[model samples]
Target: VVPGINEIYDPRTKTWSEGPERYFPTYPALFLTQGGEIFYTGSNAGYGPADEGREPGLWDLESNTFTEVGGLRDADQLETSASLLLPPAQEQRFMVLGGGGVGESEESTERTAIIDLTEENPRYRDGPPLPQGTRYLSSVILPDDTVFTSGGSEDYRGRGDSDILKAQFYDPATNSFRPAADPTVGRNYHSEALLLPDGRVATFGSDPLFGDADNTRMGEFEKRIEVYTPPYLHDGREERRPVLGEGPERAAPGETVTFATGQPGRIAEARLMRPSAVTHTTDVEQRSLQLEVRRGAGGVSFTLPEDPSLVPPGWYMLFVSDEEGTPSEATWIQIGEGLAKD
Candidate 1:
């Protein structure tokens, strides 16, 4: 709870200040504003109306304080499934798009909402609905402030489907959203999207869509990592090719690769893709690694442990992320006969 000096609180002094509240308990995501405040959305883990069970809404962070933001009235609403913090223009703003919540009844929703931070308390105004229906998807923020969201699930006309591998982008400048290149590999649950240093979006994770009768999903999880680069991009005068670096061909068995945007203030925890074989070595193994790469560092590297069991001969994908665990570029590499030095 304490980042630096550990001291007990004294109600008598009316100070010692309160502790920083941990908002993310179950896949909760947040973003940092240009004004140095944290913006987040929380979901109910079947706790109560206060937690919403499935209800999703916004939360604010300023001066180490936590305040709730826009939320759905229904306890089962999942409207704010995914979001990204847009760099301040006229005022601070957030692009919240494509999340599934309770529609008419207990059914899922496909609405999009944008939160304008310039306001006193911030306002959530509904945006143009998604081109198609979607739910349980993820998004990323580009240097130009474009938000790209990927595949999700839900039956359209009544046919139950999950692998909705479509993609879309939202631009705040115009207060509108447009479509981006779609991914070849589609996923549902447990999947994530990351923004790469080279201006492309990398996505990894698994599909929650179960197959007919008995096949099940992709062996409990996905080790496949794919990167998506914009077909066209420009800096000022000349065209700029996407320049994300390639990871190790072999990852020294258990080593990991990290990604970063080279921006300082925009730093947070990094996420990685694990091979399905990676089991719980201990209680801690159940969770993802929380490594914060130095801002403006321009790049992040994950040195493989010299241990043999940690990394064996196998191919794996590595992904890095910010504090909210929104993934960046996902580089694919193989781990073969090689030492840490090699």
Candidate 2:
């Protein structure tokens, strides 16, 4: 209902400052693009004009410009949808998941779209579709560079018992979906999935309107929690998982930090995934940045990207993935203006 109004908060100053006169829908799915620009995936939740500010695009706050990106299927049904910055954030790729019709309509779509912003002219391209039409789905970026998505409803607020229990992993490398263990409970409306530091994904909260298909029975908030363990942790691989030891507690951008790993030779890649801050399936901060790894006999070294814009000052989880794409349990690394512990 509000437009041309925005605010920015400074944690250090503990004060709110006036931001650029740009407006966004509630919980807009925006990723911080390079040079202080923001990319909106057009995935959103809650209410507004339903027409205004609904297109996917690169939003430049400095000059007050919006360059729209095309090629999204079911663009009108983006409400309750999910958007994610694809793994290895340097690729600058993003995806929008399934969503429902505008303003309480029962319609939904099983479509997905991906956009690579690195290209000269970035546009959304159709990726693999979901198994069924869903809304309010929750997604978590796994440590192994795959996205674990699960749980949504076919209708708004899971009306008509439309909650979907399907779960799948989307691999960016292959652009395909792999079957994952189905969640026991149906999740719709208020739900979220998060990646744990131990490499497991934890799911929480789902509020359905009704318990049954007829919508006769009143619904209750699901209090139980579920955790998903990816395949990398199993199959006799526990002993072989790369371990990060003796790393700095804090380091500045453009600094090289070394960690002791037993099997440095098998380390194919390392990444720093910003600790996620999400609400209602909208996570603008959830992104992964690949670190250039140099192997040493008993450890490995990761040089943080020189650009502070690429890596905002915050806490991140550093995971080293082996040749088999198996990631180690995360080690905490803080990026800021600080010296490392000798």
Candidate 3:
């Protein structure tokens, strides 16, 4: 229904504008890169050999055109696959993780791929795979720069019997994955996970259709929300979260930004987290980047990334954290052109 007709809504004018035709019918696995370009990796437009030609593509917001970038390593990963824009790096990379194949009994794939967006001809290469094949999982980036993937099904429509309980942490530094603490609830289709300001992750929702029906142990939908406290919070140390005070409401790239903090000595990290836009196991806009923090006279100072591609021109929630991984209350700041010059 989407590729057939595309429309853009303007909040200021409160009007809708018809856009160019889409390259393909996109689904949940759509993400926005640091360069302000949109990319699509997956879709729910049925499955078969015909889908092999369905490759990933990029959308130019200004020109209202879609261009095919590169094809996935495994074409079967075109549905229910989780896609995310990796944290700010020298080269922009987008990752696509586990998802089901074409059939109900078909096993899910643990294979993953990373597309280098910085390249003039972007293409995907083999990346680190998951610990195991999973679909419908919630992936959230921790403040420590690790990706945390939680509950999902091991097989398609197998949530009743193949619910994954344990969580996994993907370390980009080593290009490997390790297990993390498990949550009580089994989050599959329709579930989501988000990073909190305090460095903890909150997971919510589950397949209510099966949960509400079939009054059985396995078929019940999960209505209760679960919060996961990372290992940093309970490392047998006193909790000391940085308290952010006055700071500029807007900033520019390469600018030296200062903020007042009551616990300057405890301030060890500063970061910018883009607001989350999640639905159906897909969240393209959820990204976090570390800022260089230095102790100053009355507070702390940090330089924003010099590259606009790293910190795209938009609004971001700035947070300061201590050594124990406790983050301060988020302060909204506008970067680049969204705000007027002072």
Per TM-score, the best of the predicted structures is 2
What CA root-mean-square deviation does each model show from the true structure?
13.3, 1.6, 3.7
Q: Give lDDT: candidate 2, residue 198.
A: 85
lDDT of predicted model 1: 0.47
C-alpha local distance difference test of each model: 0.47, 0.86, 0.72
Where model 3 places Cα greater than 4 Å from the true spot, the runs are 43-53, 61-71, 89-91, 103-105, 208-218, 249-256, 263-266, 303-315, 322-326, 334-342
lDDT score at residue 191, model 3, on the 0-100 scale: 82
Q: Considering every candidate listed, which one attains the maximal lDDT? A: 2
Residue-level lDDT of model 3, residues 1-90, one tens digit each, is 544466777766999998665544345465656666677766442333434435678878788777776656666655667777776443
Which residue segments of model 2 deviate by more than 4 Å? 1-4, 338-342
Q: TM-scores for all candidates?
A: 0.53, 0.95, 0.83
lDDT of 3: 0.72
TM-score of 2: 0.95
Indicate the worst ten consecutive residues by lDDT in candidate 1. 278-287
**True-vs-predicted CA distance for residue 214, candidate 2, Å:** 1.0
Model 1 vs. true fold: TM: 0.53
* Residue 19, candidate 2: C-alpha displacement in angstroms: 1.2
lDDT of 1 by residue, 49-148 (tens): 3333232333333344455665332223443255544432224455545444433222445666667766777656777677665655666554444556
- List runs of model 1 lying over 4 Å from the truth: 1-25, 33-37, 43-67, 70-75, 88-90, 101-106, 155-159, 213-220, 233-342
